[model samples]
Target: MTDPQVEPAPTRALPLVIAPPRGRQKPPRHLADLSAEERAAAAAELGEPAFRVKQVAHHYFGRLERDPANMTDLPAKNRDAIASALLPKLLDPVRTMEADQGTTRKTLWRLFDGALVESVLMRYPERATICVSSQAGCAMACPFCATGQGGLQRNMSTAEIIDQVVDGASAMANGLVPGGPGRLSNVVFMGMGEPMANYKAVIGAIRRMVAPAPDGLGMSARNITLSTVGLVPRIKQLTDEGIPVTLAVSLHAPDDELRDELVPINTHFKVAETVEAAWEYAKKSKRRVSIEYAMMRDINDQAWRADLLGDVLNAYGDWNWVHVNLIPLNPTDSGPMLNGQVFTRSRSDDMREFVRRLEAKGISTTIRDTRGDEINAACGQLAATE
Candidate 1:
């Protein structure tokens, strides 16, 4: 007898390309890509003093100023040369769209090589958050994702990634977004790509984000969240890296058979190994790992699956080391459809029941607030289409 509550898994199969294409044009070098010492050396190579590098760093990191014309502290003769050398223009704003009564702003940027990526700044009453992309498009090829549908163009350089946050910070500092000029308090690696695949650049960007001002953005490491589709090796590497940023595992389904279809990476790293790796990360980092589950109607949103998920997470001795963030499926019109069936968001009653089942197992759970759906700026919808 078939279980009426569970829908049959999609018949479609997606090709898994673990490696990004080779020989793509590299992003231009900017100061954000280098360490403080490296930046000083580069400045000296340009015939400028080390303090000139510090002045430019202060303007870029402390005052949120990027324009050389506004950096009056530098001598007029050397200003443009230093700025041109260290702070090459990385992200050119192509178009920006606003939502949520002008509180949510999404900017589409054109990289120097013409690769398009997106960043979103969302303002709440107390704090603002920016979701930045780590790569131009994605190679993960998860069938339900819009960016995955487009495939990967290239991994963004560290400076390219940091520039998005800098742009958002500048906007907030200048009173561009609503809520009267607030500071950007949080950043999430959830915009357009699977961050773990672009590990080097992503970690570099994170280092720049948490370092003290005049050297980097000086944001708290705790305020940054990096999401991955259960990249086990990368998760273990992050555990040993000593930086304590929160880790989010996008485990859409609890069982191997279902998760293999939902998150294609599961075929290589099964559910048990993935969840255990996440648990180890939590134990080491002392930061709770987030389990991100996108609720799709009749696909992975069954109450029984929620119970299974809670059990899987609790197997590591349930020391409150994990939290389940149930995400409402933000459907994309351009996403791949299987057998003429478009993936849809779970119903309200089903979502409520899913929450109840997880909480019953002593697992903390919350439904993520869906935002910017009207303008296609929500989760899983950022493709940066021209």
Candidate 2:
């Protein structure tokens, strides 16, 4: 088959190397970064009317439809063309595993490029949430995470990220779908890649998600979250964007020495500075910042460390904005602490007692619920070793 023509992606001119590696790596390109104008141009070239671009946008971004047969607004002649133009089969279900009484679903998508990525659709009585990935393989080598162990294959484009949510949203709305028809209430970038690593595409995808129907995906800005392993500079950048979405900092440890090995980037910006920066975002955005701390047994979970965490947070008590999600570590095949995260001694009893200490210190705290444990739900785990 002749190579199909598609719109050329905008060039960053800045090369894709995060750290100058010994060898070459391909420049990252994912389809989510394109603006509506670019998508319209692409559609026009495919003989789709310029207006149908809006319809396609409505379907993918607004209506969140994948099946062309369901796109009733277009002429039957154009449905196939429009569908082929924008919603090219980015991900087809390789498999879906459900647990938590069918309320939680984990889907492994085989991308058109043959890359695999995972998204989770979890349901609660109040709202359903979709945890989506912006990259196929993560560049960050956070040891505890299954995805990090694999190293970075590449960043997923904007469409790749948005598609995961759109599909989930559609499933909820269509009722004929997998997780049942209900609008998605939350979208989180706590998946595979360091979202900041795929910065532009990730931001573009966010705009698409929150933009109104016929313009973008039409989900509320408040329902989105972009978690990072404390990328200090990007955290500042996200604050400047003023999107009002939640900012989650994966600060696995409150101290730098461990984070340097656990999160790596923290070596450049230590825990204190990262928390300060997060305070800045919270102050400006007026939204609470979430500190994602994965509690490893005998690791960072000690009562003293938790007390120190409270001390650090208390330093910035002015913002009225911060919470800790102490995630209990999920054991992996690698030796413990190879990820350089999860302290060597969490003293579960002490750690649980410590949350009381932090709260006594007036720091907001909660232990996060673990999901998708049965089906290797950890990011990059399924794609790893494949």
Question: lDDT for every model?
Answer: 0.83, 0.71
Instruction: Give lDDT tens digits, candidate 1, residues 1-386.
Output: 00000112223454677677899778777988887679878987988888888888889989888899999988998889889988999999888888888988888888998888888888888788898889887777776666776677888999999999999999998899977777999999988788999999999999999999888999999999999998899999999999999999988899999887677888899999999999999999999999888888788889889989988998996489999998887754434454465577789999999999999999999988777776778533433346
- If candidate 2 were superposed on the true structure by all CA atoms, what would the RMSD be? 7.6
TM-score of model 1 (CA atoms): 0.94
Per-residue accuracy of model 2 over 318-351 as CA lDDT, tens digit each = 6468998777555444443343342333456866
What lDDT would candidate 1 get against the real structure? Answer: 0.83
Worst 10 contiguous positions by lDDT, candidate 2 = 1-10
Clashes in candidate 1: how many? Answer: 0
The parts of candidate 2 lying over 4 Å away from their true place are: 1-33, 176-180, 332-334, 337-348
TM-score of each: 0.94, 0.87
